[model samples]
Target: MTSLWQARSHLFNDRTAGDYHRRLAEGLRRVRDRISRVDRPFTGITPTQLAARIGRVDLDRPLGGAAAALDELEELYLRDAVYFHHPRYLAHLNCPVAIPALLGELLLSSINSSLDTWDQSAGATFIERRLIAWTAARIGFGRGADGVFTSGGTQSNLQALLLAREEAAHVSEPRVLTGAAGHFSVQKAAKLLGLGPESVVVVETGGDRRMRTDALAAELERYGGAVIAVVATAGTTDFGTIDPLPEIADQCALSGVRLHVDAAYGCGLLVSPTRRHLLDGIERADSVTVDYHKSFFQPVSCSALITRKGGDLRHSAFHADYLNPARVAAHLPDQVNKSIQTTRRFDALKLWLTLRIMGADAVGLLFDEVVERASQTWELLADDPRFEVAARSALSTVVFRFLPDEPELADQANRYARKALSASGAAVIAGTRVDGREFLKFTLLNPETTIEDVADVLDLIAEHAARYAALILEEPHVPA
Candidate 1:
């Protein structure tokens, strides 16, 4: 077995430029042929059908359940199964990863490094910390800052909020003050931190989709209980709106509140010379969250929770004698201490390889390209009078709706339009209700996405809207 493994390693290491070029050609052919026309998700076939095609992947009969159950895995069930790489796929915040990052993933998986301990990871631990340090330095934390990579933005946000919870003494269910337009994960993180539903104070926002600092100040003054932290959205989930971080930072500083910035959307801009200005007040934040997957274009699961305070991860730090012995390099970081998951994958490897190859500016430029695509989308929509934009903030998500004659049916129309499109297997788009008005969202996180593609989707939207409107009119027997 050892000889076989060593031989396999040798073959893998022998992956040359020519081999990669050949593989890329195969990938391009598969993607172009299978995904070009597919706008909507493809889930018609079951896992059993897929297995049949692969000729029976035997379940419970092989190593680590490797051959286990391919009988029902639905590729379309998961967001990733859908073709995010398709030019027309303007549905989610997911980005098609850099080719090099995928290669890095392959390398790391083959090595199978467990990040929980230094004995398992060794050089990998330092690489992860180095990447964290690089990210931390950009946030102005310098020597005082430290961080840990997480599975994605959700985990990163959760970790930052937990740090705040610890600061709040875990007493009386600490309250979290956040913008009304904050990411869904903020409330989830609050709940996970034991803040509960009642503890979350969804503060009103200013014109920029940021929580009004004045409103937060008022909430702080009136609230009797200890405020755990003020969570600001550096990049909102839906509208891509950036909260007023500087102003929020001032409030948190004055009120002695821990400020956690969820910059998962906008963090990539920190590397952009042109757009880094969006994160002005992030320096004042006690902790900040960033997702390398979204705009950084690393892969599916590269996220980090960074802090200006070195010991902020205290709450997450574990004390298993078997895992963490104080005698073993008191400064050594065991991944188990800072992350929510144990037996975590070596996600940092791709990130390390990414930053190493692309450099920070190249990575930042990738985000810059996406932002530019978003601007182009704005221009595309501006030309058409049939569509009404809900809002177009600085980040990638653009919310708009078709204007039907009956405003009353606007919500239903918006929801159904998206449903009909996805059901047809033609294209996939995102939808959300804004101020009771349902709207379709164009979330452009992919750098490969073009203005023409967005235009194509908008045209499809108009066509779908008209079709649905005609249906509403024709189905006279049913109440509108």
Candidate 2:
């Protein structure tokens, strides 16, 4: 024990700088090699198989060296890990992260800055505040706008609804209005806020998957004084459809209801050179949620909840004598006052480095590329007779299903195709139920993915689906 204390090889400090540098370099090199060698998004390994491999590890014994540990990790984890950067990975909202943001991630992890207070984080507090102000300005908010970084879209939505709930404390019974296509997080947030299960009223959406202003107006009038807030989605997850923001804002204003725009997916449009007008009415929102990890190419857990009036964030504020005391709250820049979390990571640094190194336009262009790719994908699906598309998206998702010779077998065919494609590791895609029928979805967030890749995946899906349908048909019919 005395020798161990004297060595101090494990701790990160001035004395262990060399050890830290060497270990980190070894780890990075192994990751870089693995990424470069990856040819597919997944290895088709089942959960049980991976679990057995992990379970066999002897936790009591240590590798004792970085190289040996990395070698073990490569086989146990890196060899079968899903590579989101692969062009064939057309799955969820995950994006191929930016290199600059990776650098920020490295620096922040090493420094280990806690962003809850000024004394803990120092300059990091101001950096986060500046980024918040910059994002608010992009949303067309005035100097009174303010916000704090959050973990992701779910937390941002929760914080926004929390503020809205507190603002309507005077109302006897308050209802939250949102589109049928809005995110499920809104419902979860309502539950966490101690509201009744029926507190959230889902307004019907039109054929285009947008919340119909007429339906919204009717709901507003029906609820009348009970309606406390209207939550509008800038981008629906399944259809990638955006609600009619200008009309929704108008209705909310007239009804004296606070408007919270959940733009977690569509916030990328704020910097889109060619399509910023899609969010024209977002400036009128009382609060907005932005997820930088989704469309901005930043790493996971980088998101914010910006409010038009900075004071609205006071709902989340609670002073602790040991941390942010009430006496010095005015003088110190304590971010915990406006955040739902304490001891938050310095996530803002990732976006800060991304902006400083590559600028916002470059990130926007990457998103534009994916959006264009999705359009091309839609055209491909629309022209193909083997598939039936649900609806064209305004963003980077295309929802469609493979149609079999027998219409009744369409759902099974599509479902089998999705599972087969994923299991083969040739490609990865998402699935969802539309109108009570199964459909496959392609969320094109990787700019590197091309039309040819999508076309090849389509052919594979058709093959798998056709095989499944054929197998079913070959089964002998038994008399009931």
Candidate 3:
């Protein structure tokens, strides 16, 4: 007689349902325990050491069951995985996902619905379309506007630029224009579109870290009919600086240039009660990108590229008999017709569930709280004697450097401080170069992170910087 585990002909059958539930329950228990007692956000291991430890896992052999496999994962990955939910993990744009979104994840995985066509995903198609409509309305688009969920802001931007490229194909040698501090993907999109690296003309930024409309006007005139699209950043990655959208929109309108707003980072302001006004002229854009994962507290891959005119999406559509054929797709609204991706996951469900449970205002309040926290942190750092801070944050990032006695040692001290913080695993923050000098950044996305937590991290950074400075002074230089 066969064993009970081997008795089932296929997975997910009635016989295996109990086993699946058991595994899921066990996994959740482990996660709860880990989250409750996790003191460090990271394991603080060297890359080489981590690689050696992970190498011990044999992928060729079967782990026998989910219990065994999960145990191995816990040891090899979970213990070392960066936890964004932690109060001290202020490294990047990663946000702690809402509980409702996790429920959506579970439902999507269980159903495995692909939102390419109506047949493959009947209700899923309508669900995603409803979300698109909701988001487009939030952007103040007219009824003619349409959008599709994308993998992230990068893909959304690519789609927006691709549409712009197609619309401008009538003009010879059309070029893309964006702010100097715009996301790197705009340049990447230009290159990917077969426009050479030089095809993107960067407009200079002003003292306020916003796009200089005067310089933009000059460039537009210089390019004349050669400019296709003017890309405006709603929120910059490093500084969380929002470009002057109202001014940029006026310039784009006057120049007859198609405007594309990359609001991937600041799109959450749509619901943010305190800062939504910062997105003033985004409504006038011909196209826009929004990443729910970044600020909406949704899971990864929840982003959309929206366009004012529905016809603009035609550039990305392709028909095949096996998939979304033109005839069938015309009869019913198929998401694949508007997206660059086919067989896309039901990521919209996560946002849908999030909205249904938490309401949009609550989500906005969470973001508002974090932005407030960033303000508090900026105040603390600016008042502290150890840091030389930059301009006040427009969103939720604080960029500053360690103040050393010697100006020459400032860059090295900042870099060393960042490395030491990461190696110690007390907290993880980001670093960037500002005007050729290194600066540490606090990308505060976690609402749970208190001002006290930020102060402690700052203290650690100062201690580390001081130690490095002393070591550098101790080094004797040989006469050349």
TM-score of each: 0.85, 0.97, 0.96
Which sections of candidate 3 miss by over 4 Å? 1-10, 476-480
In model 3, the clashing pairs are none
Q: How large is the C-alpha RMSD of every model relative to the true structure?
A: 5.1, 2.1, 2.5
For model 1, the superposed segments whose C-alpha errors exceed 4 Å read 1-80, 170-173, 329-333, 477-480
Local lDDT at 385 for model 2: 99
Model-by-model lDDT, in order? 0.77, 0.92, 0.89
- Pairing residues by index, what is the TM-score of model 1? 0.85
User: Residue-wise lDDT of candidate 3 within 1-480, one digit each (tens)?
Assistant: 556757463367577788778877898888888888899788787898889988887877667777788888887888888999988999899999899999999889878999988898999999988888898999999899999999999999999989998998997787889998889999989888888887899999876677898999999999988999999998888888888989989988998999999999999899987888989999999999999999999999799998889889999988778887778876887777799889899999999999999999999999998889988988998898889887676788899888988777888888988888998999999998888889999999999999999999999998888877878888724110
Steric clash pairs (candidate 2): none
